[model samples]
Target: MSAVLDVVLSSAFLAAVLRVSTPYLLAAFGGLVAERAGVSNIALEGQMLSAACTGALVAGYSGSVALGALCGVGVATLLGLLLAALRLELGADVIIAGIGLNLLASGGTAYAVFTLLDDKGGTSGLKSGSLPAVPLPGIDSIPLLGDVISGQNMVTWLAFLTAPVIAWLFYRARFGFHLRAVGEMPDAAASVGIPVRRVQYTGLALSGALAGLAGVFLSMGYVSFFVRDMTAGRGFIALAAVFLGGLRPWGVFLAALGFGAAEALAVQLGTLDVPPQLVSTIPYAMTLVALAVYAWRRRRQAGVEVAASV
Candidate 1:
């Protein structure tokens, strides 16, 4: 009885991990695109928050969850383009631009909620707004693996499916090569006829779109309404994932999964006889530890390479 219970319990935990990690995976992919093109996209928080509002408002009014999700992506793309214009073209500082965007999202969501929804702080009890889940056939009958791998939100599945594709695009494609070159050496890439500005603009735009989808997942799929600053600190956490994964798609995916597991565990443990405050910190604490491990390993590897060269 104990052995069977342990398997069941572990399976449940894995399912929770995958569900929680879905959002991080999307955000991490978005960040990866910009970073590979030499832009640090710290505005993920703002982009997601703004899109959440757009998705919730549109879905609530139009009664179409799909449309709301697309709208979220559209808004994110627009914001990304604006950031590109300021940072890549006008030479505005990326860090400052990110901060400004975050502020804009925080303020914009609140104002939109009040003005449009006639609500206080957020769009609570929103009606006719919900993203549907997708179910995988046959996979539901495979015991422990079944529940964890089947019947998830469309975006959740997309996040995983997109990982290998992103990896190939980054490492194997011509455009990927150009993006990497620009990041490593802008002057060298430009001299070779690559349009640095154009690449940066497109990269940032796509990053925004993916982040927007993440926002949609939060507002329409994860929950039924929009809340002010509901993205909380996920944007920053995704940034950590980028570094922790060493800018590699596979690494980042695993890192995102790790964070997701932490989140799932936190939620599960919260139901137990534990302090709410400590439980709340579980995900962030896990991220910090992961980051430290990544840094230490990277440094150790660098030392080994240096010794070999000597």
Candidate 2:
């Protein structure tokens, strides 16, 4: 009986880990697109924040989750375009622009919630219709594997499915070749008649749409309402995942799962006979450790490469 209980508990925790990792996967994908196009998209947090507010409000009003998600993505795209115009066209520094956007998101969302929805800090007790669950065909009958792969939110399924497609598009397609060229050497790409600014704009827009998907998952797939600054620094964590994953799709997936597992453990430990504060710090602590590990590996690899070159 004790062994059986242990197995069941482990499975439950694994499920929680997968659930928490979904957003990181999505945001990391977004970062992948932008960074691969030579644009540092530090504005993911702002874009997601805007999308969360839009998704919750639209869902609450129209009572249609799909429409709400569409609206959320639309808003994110517009913001992306705005940022592109400022950074690529108007010569603003991308990093500074991103910081400004994050600050705006933090303050603007709180004000909108209180002034518009009459909520103090969030859209509390509101029902934002949920995205439907998708069961992979024939997978639902495969016992444990079925449960793991099937019956996830639509957004979650999309996030998992899209990663490989994005990877292929980035590396295997003609357009992808162009994107890589822009990222690696913009001057050379421009000499060959490639419009670098256009590529950057497209990448930013795509990144914004992906971030919006993350916001929709938060409001509709995971919860019923939007809370103030609910993303909780997920954007920065996604940035870390992007770099730690070595800018590859599958690598990003693994990084996301690792962090998700840590977060799940933190939540579970909080329930045991442990210090609440210590349990709460576990996830962030894991993140710092993971980053340190990543840096060490990078340095080690660089040393090996230099030694081989010598």
Candidate 3:
């Protein structure tokens, strides 16, 4: 209990939670957009992994964060388009395509990194450039809040700001309407003369762009270099966040924060007297708990509806 309180009271722990959650937030948002558009984009893991390597490699060679991010987004989006083409045009199953893409990314990144820098591990040897960090000017003057809010990586701040923008886009914009229509009722949307495939493609592209940024943030902003499989299942966690949030943007944001806190707690606990094995299970335990609770509520709601109908 004291250890938990210590972590909660520590400013560094709060900051770690934000940092750990950043990739999840970005990836969850991407998954949310794609899922909302009915894409079932399980390939977010692959997309992020691919972008991490590409972003690191490009930034190392070019020495510019901007171009690195742009290239990363482009590569990841192309991968997304390819997945769409495979699933839509060639009749491939979405899950299969996603898994295949992940395998491809894992192998391809290893080979590319080895060829570029003779390292199968990652881009740690390369002089890769990182995205700039920015401090909130006035917020830094505050007491406890300043430590939590200020001096985050630029992409971290962007991820937070992007939530409202995406929400507004969904609630206000015509493109959002089209995407939602295509997602919710493809047959009806088609009947209305909406080119369903095109809209689906656009949705995936947007999702890919966001996932690419997450990858870029992982390598360029989070760590300043690429590592093999460094995403460490954050992509899958983002998918979990998508479901946990009921595909709502703000809901997913909160869920991501929870997972981040769990992760940060695990890190903190690792340094304490607790068993290492027990400490390592904290994050996964949190995931299981969240899912179990969600399942229970869903079943309860269905049972109530059936009872009322009877």
Candidate 4:
């Protein structure tokens, strides 16, 4: 017990939390953006998986990390546009279309990997390098703070910055106002001459880009190689964070951070005399509990509204 507490209290644990939370933060914000645009991007999982695979393969073959990251993000943005088109042009159900995209990404990435590398596992055989880490010279000299913040992956720094950037976008930007207005009432927004469809399309593209960044981080920043389904369920977990955070930027940031902390704790506990299986389940279990609490709060709010109306 004391040992566990010590581990949790250490600066290393804080750093681990930031590292683990990077993908979650990015993906959750992606979902939040799409949701605010009145489109639920359930294909976040697919986007992350596809991006991870694409980034690794591109980097490995081209020997250019920048180009690889660009291609990966481009692919995800295209997927987002694809989702928007399916919904807007074909009148297809967004949820169903997103699910289809997810499935397609899962199968498509795996096939691409096997076809190119002849490996069923992943791009482990490739020599793809990792993204550069940012070393804060002066900051690194600080005791606990330096230990926690210095020498993190560039993606990790971007992940932390995204929270504030998104907040500014949501409240202080013109596009954000349009996005919110369109989401709240498309008919009204259109009546006022706002291009509803265009805004939605843009929002979804941004969402995909953010998720793609998360995916790239997994393969190119978290490690030098990609694994099949390396995203594991981070996209879905990030979606949960979006809702659990009340669909707000800062709220989503905290929610994602909390999830990251849980996962980090689980990893730390694994080194202890704990059951590996039980420790691994901690993050998922927390997700379930969070969902349950959110649902109950929503139901209670609904009941209160009904009573007030009555």
Q: Write the candidate numbers in order of decreasing lDDT.
A: 4, 3, 1, 2
Model 3 per-residue lDDT tens digits across residues 165-281 = 888878899888888898999999999998999988988888888898999999999898999998888888888888898777789889988888888888887888889999888
TM-scores for all candidates?
Answer: 0.93, 0.92, 0.96, 0.98
- Which one wins on TM-score? 4
TM-score of 4: 0.98
* Model 3 residue pairs with clashes: none
As a whole number from 0 to 100, the lDDT of residue 187 in candidate 4 is 100
Candidate 4 Cα misplacement greater than 4 A, ranges: none
Clashing pairs in 1: none
Per-residue lDDT of model 4, residues 1-310, tens digit only? 9999999999999999999999999999999999999999999999988888999999999999988888888889889999989998899999899899999998999899999999988999998888999999999999999999999999999999999999999999999999999889999999999999999999999999999999999999999888888888999999999999999999999999999999999999998999999999999999999999999999999999999999
Residues 83-188, candidate 2: write the lDDT tens digits.
7888888889989998888889888888988887888778876777788888789987876777676777878778878778888998899878888899889999
Quote the positional error of residue 130 for candidate 1 in Å. Answer: 2.0
Task: Kindly indicate the candidate among 1 and 3 with the higher lDDT.
Answer: 3
In order, the Cα lDDT scores of the candidates are 0.86, 0.82, 0.88, 0.94
Best by lDDT: 4
Q: Is candidate 2 or candidate 3 better by TM-score?
A: 3
| Regions more than 4 Å wrong, model 1 | 1-8, 301-310
